[model samples]
Target: MEPNNEQAQGLYRLCYRLTNVIYPGWQYRPIQLVRIDERTGNVYVLAGESDFEIKPTGGYEP
Candidate 1:
């Protein structure tokens, strides 16, 4: 159950765009990619040494 080249590439593009929004001015690196849980539909994006957790709770925090 592995993604094909095209699927992988598309996921990478998606990760890049999402990361750019969350962390402005981010340039894609070799480690960046999107991970999904096929059963739960949970998506995670690579960020630094860990994956950026997408949480539903929203508000401005600084």
Candidate 2:
């Protein structure tokens, strides 16, 4: 999928705020924004299925 500059900027800002990590440099994988229904807690990734969550494990490096 094509990168959305606005979304990318928002993601980068959020990343920096949360972890002090700059995107596309500090992160190895493509990071995406997701939305969840507060009532249902159903999560939806912004860039569709191409950008889904990968839970970090104990041995996870990125």
Which model scores highest in lDDT? 1
Name the lDDT value of residue 5 in candidate 1: 55
Q: Which candidate has the top score in TM-score?
A: 1
**RMSD, each candidate, Å?**
7.9, 10.8
Assess every candidate by TM-score.
0.36, 0.31
Quote the lDDT for 23 in model 2: 46
Name the TM-score of candidate 2. Answer: 0.31
* Cα deviation of 49, candidate 2, in Å: 20
Q: Candidate 1, residues 1-62: lDDT per residue as tens digits?
A: 34445545555555665456466565544346556556544445665565653322211111
List, in order, the clash count of every candidate structure.
0, 0
lDDT of each: 0.48, 0.39
Task: Looking at model 1, report the run of 10 residues with the lowest lDDT sum.
Answer: 53-62
